[model samples]
Target: MGCTTSRYATGKKKPVPIREIVVFVPSTRVPKEIDLRRPLRGSLSEGLLERLAALRAKVVALSEKWSLNCSTPTGNIATED
Candidate 1:
């Protein structure tokens, strides 16, 4: 049996469990004075920019999916289990 205190009450009003997720993104610092007009051909900057774009897309998708899953009703989740 569960505790009877109001603080320990079970049901929809109960606090939802939470887990922290951390993602480390590697990056390099560039000087502000770097010439923007310079071409990126055959340089590490080109590859880094491409990888950043891909990571941004993946992060956006994951955020959307997590929001949907967390907002779902607990009853619906329990039934599916």
Candidate 2:
């Protein structure tokens, strides 16, 4: 899961050095799902559809455990603004 040195891979595929641990989670009340039932003209690519499905599943998993031990953000997120 990591390199030989104290470094972690992030963003791009290349390995890079990281100074500290960061937890990046979206903080917002779950939005209600609405099905507008919009039609599509052609079949979407299989890779795109697979990635979308994975994202949907991840959201569902996160939402289910979202209420358990939720903590208030204690630090400023903007490092340089």
Which candidate number has the best lDDT?
2
TM, every model: 0.38, 0.34
lDDT string, candidate 2, 1-81, tens digits = 333454446656666655455665656455466432233214666576667667766776777567443564466554432
RMSD to the hidden true structure, all candidates:
12.5, 13.5
User: Considering summed lDDT, which 10 consecutive residues are worst modelled in model 1?
Assistant: 28-37
Candidate 1 local lDDT, 35-75, one digit each (tens): 32245445647777677557666666666666666555444
In TM-score terms, candidate 1 sits at: 0.38
- List candidate 1 stretches off by more than 4 Å: 1-44, 75-81
Pairs in steric clash, model 1:
none
Instruction: Give me the displacement of residue 32 in model 2, in angstroms.
Output: 7.3
